[model samples]
Target: MSYQHYRLEELARLVQGELVGQADLCLQGLASLELAEPQHIAFVNADKYVEQAKVSKAGALIVTPELQQQLDTHQNFIVVANPYLAFAILTHVFERKHTQTGIESTAQIHPSAIISESAYIGHYVVVGENCVVGDKTIIQSHSKIDDFVEIGKECFIDSHVTITGEAKIADRVRIHANTVIGSEGFGFAPYQGKWHRIAQLGSVQIGNDVRIGSNCSIDRGALDDTILEHGVIIDNLVQIAHNVKVGANTAIAAKCGIAGSTIIGKNCILAGACGVSGHLSIADNVTLTGMSMVTKSISEPGTYSSGTGALPNAQWKRAVIRFRQLADVPLTQLQKRLDHMQTQIESLESTLKLRK
Candidate 1:
């Protein structure tokens, strides 16, 4: 994607940074230090990468004032308090160029559906009966909004996403491609010798500013709503089971599986590949490290981790043997202590009888 050039002074104003470069110099987009061209801008956050910044071919460099002396030339320095944050700001501006601004005529809208005129529906998209798509929302191609679904304003639903009927999605939400929302939960009962599937009658309620990555599966509740509160960011390939409640601003990384009826608290971070068991309550501000297994409820707000790192085969074998011996060691020590105490007690009793 191509972007129009923004002047150094304008960029500084936009990102709330201090200008140290020639204000008239234009920057089209952001680039890494090694790949930057004369039309691009780059940022250096640490002194360790200052050498790369000096050799970069960027027209402008966003850096801290302390690091400005390391630059090859003073002509392209855009000094800031935080160079990383400045880079994020510039990248966001550059990315906005690729966003769809208006609706396309090729979109398929059901006669019973209501889509705001301000919404942008991309090519070959389908909006089912009685569906309500709000203002400034963008539904990309090959995406399906199933019957009676309500999507709020400024939502971005990427291509090939499937949102089942009766699902409620709020404003500023972003859903990536091929994700299945509001699917039936896994619920079955054993009747005699056969399994009887339970009917899932509940829907999913996704709140504002939520971001769901590609290929994630969020199952609908069995009898109540499966809720994802505002600002929840879920990564790709994650599985969120039925009746799960993920609190506001909680971020769950890729490949995490949350079982049914789990309540994950606000501002929590569940790292990649972590598995959380069902019917548990995890408190706010908790951080579960990568590949950690959560089998119990956590009421405290802190970082909890499990699982061991890789080790050499010989050392690992020794560690496992020692672990097995741990149970025997305590029992042997207790027995020896008990025997010594009994001997001392018998001697005292004999001395007392002789004295009497």
Candidate 2:
């Protein structure tokens, strides 16, 4: 009951929508059409949900002009171009404001580090020497910022997150809990029958408006920087190996792993559990379906799916048996059979032409 309240007209103005019906009606929060109460606002995206929106017991509804003409009911409405987008805009209006308590007593910030007065350092957060924390940035409890790191303004560093070994995070970035930035990548040299450790000398450069989810590991480069460009959204449990460069506005789903030195272009979509091998370059506007494995470089932009789709157990068994049998055939014999078939097909085509 203590949440924010807005008039029907005010909510409409926020989303640049046209207001219809009662302007004085107070909307408390947003909800789905089926779950909306009298004080809540609901949104109907498509025409299919127009009936549900009409019957919803909500204070108001956010809808398109096309859907607005269909409703003859007395329910108040806020008409927008995109009802879903309007709902997204209004969510920030009802977001609860958390009070900043300044720097907590247990936070260990170095004297040489430039901590902004507007920033909030939570309990037991460790900030190393020569670090620069910009204004309004919140380093939550149990987080660690290593030496020479720079975090820009209005960034959110969640609890148990580690920004270490030359991490440079830009403005409005959100790194969720337990995520590690600038960790040493998997690089070694085999010398004299032993593996020699190769130091990761480079940093992680994350651009503005990047949102990294929980438990993700972004490894530092062996020489050059590992870059995540602006507006990149990374899901949880993702592993990005050394020197990998991900372009702007790319969305990588959960559990995807990209090996060393790969360059993924802008506006690409990598579905869940997709694995890309080392040193490959993926073109822009490409989409990889779930469980796709890429071993070579992709030069063209298109949706690519690799491996086999799920099938019935009996069908899958038969497919596996056929695949194994094909593997057992000698390469020279297979080529000879293919050549003979091609010659016979050509002869048949010639005979058909003569008869015509």
Candidate 3:
């Protein structure tokens, strides 16, 4: 990939940072302070990294104005209020150099499929009959888009992704590699002493700007649609069960399992390995800590947590015994206190009557 030079002032404006050094200095790419070359740009967010920034061979560095005074300013500097944020912006600029563009000739697109001319179909991809591939959507290698699937414009379906039949994915959605969408949910009924399979006829409806990470499984609804609202971001190895309705902008971390028919509210954050029970309603803005087992509905927006931390075996045994005894001890103490208070009240009432 050919490196593109960006002016220091242009980079500062792109990241919304104030420029302090020579604005006309050209930065080719971004690199770590220690590894930066003359064509690359580096950043120093803390005093600890200032030494590396000073010795770096990079043409320019992004740093806070306070830290710039401590370092060698021989190389041009872009002074930003937040150097970390500026670094994040420059990372994207450098990463775009490796991005793929246009369709490959070896891509296996079905004749019946309505793929937009602007879409990029990569190698060994299979687009099934009656599918609609939207404008500027890139379907990478080994991806299988099943029949009746609709992918909206500007979406990035990464390599080895599988979108099963009737799945509807909206605009600007990004699905990482090996993620399975619209698979059959776990639904069964006991009929005549045998387990009868319940057909999962409903499809998955994914909203715009949603990002699903690698190896995630989103099961199709059993009877109604399994819906993920706009801007919802899900991490790797997450299992979203049948009929699960996740509200807009809710971010769920890796290894979380949301059971069937659970309605998770908007802007909620479910941390890694958290298990949410079926048919429960989780209120908005609720944050579930890592490894939490949510077995009931959470109506309030406040942070709630359950699960005991690990301790030494001997200490844990003693703690368990005390925990069991607490129920009886509290009642016994309350009864003794109530009896003493009653006796005092009677003596006070008798004295009051005598005085009257």
Candidate 4:
């Protein structure tokens, strides 16, 4: 939790914030309002957290202009247009800098693999033949890079990660531990009462500035490469099936599943635990709320949600029972009754016209 100290004035200037106290106040690290110490800085973004900020022990606070107005005029704080954004910037400054460089002796490198001198290859890492690991990249312990894979500069591949099937990764990508890239997708053909597996011959292409969280699986394509556009961020435990194309700057939350060949447009957000059916096309800037299920293609860009929110167990059981009985309802008889009523209405109208 150690941090390099910075002056209050300098910190405010770095985040484009307005200072309200002594410029020389020494700040060491960032913390939540409840956990902040005398030398730490905290933030209060919304009115709900104002009470907590007022009693916090932090030497300095970062707050929005509206929130600052409610605080004491003499309080030591920094006013920013977006307090959360300012706090995010400070997190980078507080993170510990990595100093390890050079390949570990225990790492296995193939004869045809190209390793950069500045790259850090941790113990037990295997670089396959014809693979290119770019400058300053870090491949942590127990990770395997298969043949012909290309990883760009400044990428971080965490421990126990597997990259195979000629996967191509661009610069500044961060793949967390236990993630499997270019794995075979679920593709089977039914023939003569038996199931046959299809040979997956495609690879995966990841664009720059993408961060994939731990325990996620991104499968390779059946023929073409599965593509992830630049600036994509995927949360933990997500499943991306074969030949799926995720557009630029899309953020997918944890536990989401995208079926094979689905094309998700740019800037879309799929919330946690959502599922998209196979081969569906999702428009750009679409937002699917948590636990949504998409069985059809979305052509318009807007927020979408599905599934009933939380309900009591008793009510949910009754609803499920009602839904199950819908198939038994006699729709043909209902239509016949409606047709008879329409005939009677036409007869009465004719009689009224004759009397007039």
Candidate 5:
């Protein structure tokens, strides 16, 4: 791996962290606490990992103030308010120094395409008719940008990405490899006992600083654009359907499926494996826990969860049986039992009052 050395003091100053270690110690790269080399920097983000940090052979460590105080070893360390955030900053610094730039000679650009001089088009990349690629944007090898697509400045389109016609991607967007944007949405009408396909005539509009992960399929709308607002982050294997509006800064994790015409509010977090049904509106700041199934609108902002926690096989089977039985019980019978209990309580209260 290509490596660059930075002094412990310099690294700490870059992240505005307090340094407690030897200033002159050079760090080559980042590594996990368990596997850190003598030239590498490691981080302890939580208390659980502090033991690992103590045993690590890293040249320097980045740790939260709390963690640093609790660590048993007197070691070279940078004390940051948030170790995870510091690590993230360092990662960006590392990535920028290593990332490739500049256009390749073998890229196929249409005569009508408007590509900025500063944009990088990789080998075997195809830029279609009337497409506009903004300054400093990088379209990686084997990726296809269809006609009339407008990609803004500083965007990174990874290899094998397919951005279909008329899609608008805003500045600083990062789409990972194998992602398919502006694909036809799932729309069909039943007629004469047969399913007739409906044309997806709209496009996709992705806002600034959005990061979409690998292998994601974001479908175009039927008549309006499927929108992802600024700072939205979508994880791998996500399926965002037609006309869906994912509000600003919302984060949807891996394997999440959001159905057509659903409006997910700002700063919402849909955890991994979550599924939202069609036409639902999830309010701002809502958090759906992992594997939760949302079937209707979420009108309030709060953490939501579904499905039982892991259980032993025999216990799980019994729980499943009881769960099915609960659904089978009549609502009328339940209400009658509740009424009887209320009546008994009232009778007891009356007798107590008489005795008093």
Candidate 6:
């Protein structure tokens, strides 16, 4: 395995940071402050971590301009406005350079499929008829592509993944291992004693820069295509049901399940284990915290949280009992009446003050 080495001056230019160290210093990898070696670079994101930087064995550090005073004078530094962001930029420098492993002989490709000359189709991979695989796209081993599917440029489709239902994926999209795209939605009509199946006729449309993690199931639509706009990131084990439209730049964390026809607006964040019911519209810039269960539509942009955080066992049990007791009471009606009486009393007081 060959690692790419970059000089300090080159890394500084790449991250747009000011280098205050030997320009000729060569770095091979990026590591944490504690684990970094002489050949690797580390980062200090906050002032609180300055003490650790003092003891770190890292050859160089990415630090903000403000932290320069606290950073060790003996250590080399790359100064930037945001140390963490600069560190992220430097990560690309050390990323694995993907060598195009030209199409494997064992791969099965239909004659009608238009696979770019630059694309890499791994062993046992299947490309169906009328499919279009664009430039530099890598479809790893054992992956299956259904008929008429269009995967755009620079996409990465990992091993054992299945893309069916004539899905159209745009540039720079990444579908991790074992994920399924455009699978038939769960549509059924309740008959006398059974469920009659409704054929899912639509497909899926994934925009540019979308990242889908492993084991995710994005169901095809019943009428319209289930869509994921550009810059959308989905974590592992998420279930996106039929006809869902996830807006651009939205991030959905692990174990989330969104039912059919839900439109999640742009810049939204759905934290881990969140569940959104069918037919709900969540406005842009909204955030659903971890373990939240959303049943109603959110019309405004804000951070929303549901479900109780961890509590002591005895207290949680008592809280649960109280909740049950409240369900049995007419507390809502009483509260309304009390609110009306308070309004009346305030009106009387205002009238009395005017007379005085």
For TM-score, the strongest prediction is 2
Model 6 vs. true fold: TM: 0.93
Candidate 1: tens digits of C-alpha lDDT, residues 75-174: 7777888999888878878776335566578878899999988888888888899999998898989898999999999898999999993899999999
Across 107-214, the per-residue lDDT of candidate 5 in tens digits comes to 898999999888889999999999999998989899999999999999999999999949999999999999999999999999999999999999999999999999
Q: Which scores higher on TM-score, 3 or 6? A: 6
| Model 4 spans > 4 angstroms off | 333-356
Each prediction's TM-score against the native? 0.87, 0.95, 0.81, 0.91, 0.92, 0.93
**How much is the lDDT of residue 292 in candidate 6?**
98
Report the Cα lDDT for candidate 2. 0.94
Candidate 2 lDDT tens digits, 142-256? 9999999999999999999999878899999999999999999999999999999999999999999999999999999999999999999999999999999999999999999
Candidate models: Cα lDDT each: 0.91, 0.94, 0.89, 0.94, 0.92, 0.94
Q: Which ten residues in a row have the lowest lDDT in candidate 2?
A: 93-102
**What C-alpha lDDT does candidate 1 achieve relative to the native structure?**
0.91
For candidate 4, lDDT tens digit of each residue in 1-356? Answer: 45599998988999999999889999999999999988998988899998888888999999988898887833788899999999999998877866688989999999999999989999999999999999999999999999999999999999999999899999999999999999998899999999999999999999999999999999999999999999999999999999999999999999999999999999999999999999999999999999999999999999999999888999999988887786666889768988999999999999999999
Q: Which residue pairs does candidate 6 place in steric collision?
A: none
Off by over 4 Å in 2: 346-356
Q: Tell me how many residue pairs clash in candidate 4.
A: 0
**Cα TM-score of candidate 3:** 0.81
TM-score of 5: 0.92
lDDT of 4: 0.94
Candidate 5 residue runs with Cα over 4 Å from true position: 96-102, 341-356
* C-alpha lDDT of residue 290 in model 4: 100
Instruction: Give candidate 3 misplaced runs (Cα > 4 Å).
Output: 32-39, 42-84, 97-105, 310-356
lDDT of 3: 0.89
